[model samples]
Target: MSKSSVYSWRIDPVLKQDLEQAARTEQTSIAQLLEQIVQDWLYKKSSPDDEEVQQRLHEAASQTFGAFRSRDSKGSEKVRERVRAKLRQKRATQRPD
Candidate 1:
């Protein structure tokens, strides 16, 4: 266990009541809930900016782009044609002679 210290501050009675209710609902003590809230806020504050996120997404897409491409140059059109053909074959097989 780590060392702990007590800190007190004034808050509106209604807000205190809401905090208590929330802590009870979460099955945690008010101190623990407050600690978790502070930790989450710090984590979010340290997250990457929008440009960094976009750069990361672009890098990932570049790495995986055309990874599943078919031999044909028009892979998407070929895939659609193959799917339609399979569906037609299935429907024909299900029909009575």
Candidate 2:
């Protein structure tokens, strides 16, 4: 004869309440519900199609963020305002020239 194994985990109060409500509605135990979720997760994780999508997402993120680039702040807000005002004045003068 073989023996069954048991495991334990701590869940948040709100999550536990929600699970209990769902289990009651489905006429199932929390353990069974959790087992079904884990089985589905394992199946999806082992699928090769999901792995390719995950890799593409990682590559896209790296490209969008400029691949680990650092930005240096050469001018403060006051300096930026002054520079912008000067540029605007220069453009206005050139328009009349």
Candidate 3:
């Protein structure tokens, strides 16, 4: 578990009402909504200036590939081999060379 800090602050009632409505519509508590909003804001603020956009952007493909691996031996290699096998099967069916 990670440590968290609590702080007190005030916002306009109108804004708070809007946030509450949005939170309700999203089926989440206001606290979780606010936490997620703050986390998202902080992440965007910390990101590169060139990354400021409404569309969600992912990291470089090479950087993300093989990020999650199984507990088994040669996990990444196994995944690659499976993908290759599927491609080979598809091509064999399609071209029959």
Best by lDDT: 1
Q: Give the winner by TM-score: 1 or 3.
A: 1
Q: What's model 1's TM-score? A: 0.50
Q: 68, model 3: CA deviation in Å?
A: 46
Collision count for each candidate, in order = 0, 0, 0
Model 3 lDDT vs. the true structure?
A: 0.81
lDDT of 3 at 34: 89
- lDDT for model 1, on a 0 to 1 scale? 0.90
Point out the higher-scoring one by lDDT: 2 or 3. 2
What is every candidate's alpha-carbon RMSD to the true fold? 9.3, 12.1, 16.0
Tens-digit lDDT track of model 3 for 37-85: 9999999888866644323354544455565545787876588889999
Pairs of residues clashing in candidate 2: none
Model 1 stretches with alpha carbons more than 4 Å out: 49-52, 55-97
How much is 14 displaced in model 3, in angstroms? 0.1
Per-residue lDDT, model 1, residue 62, is 90
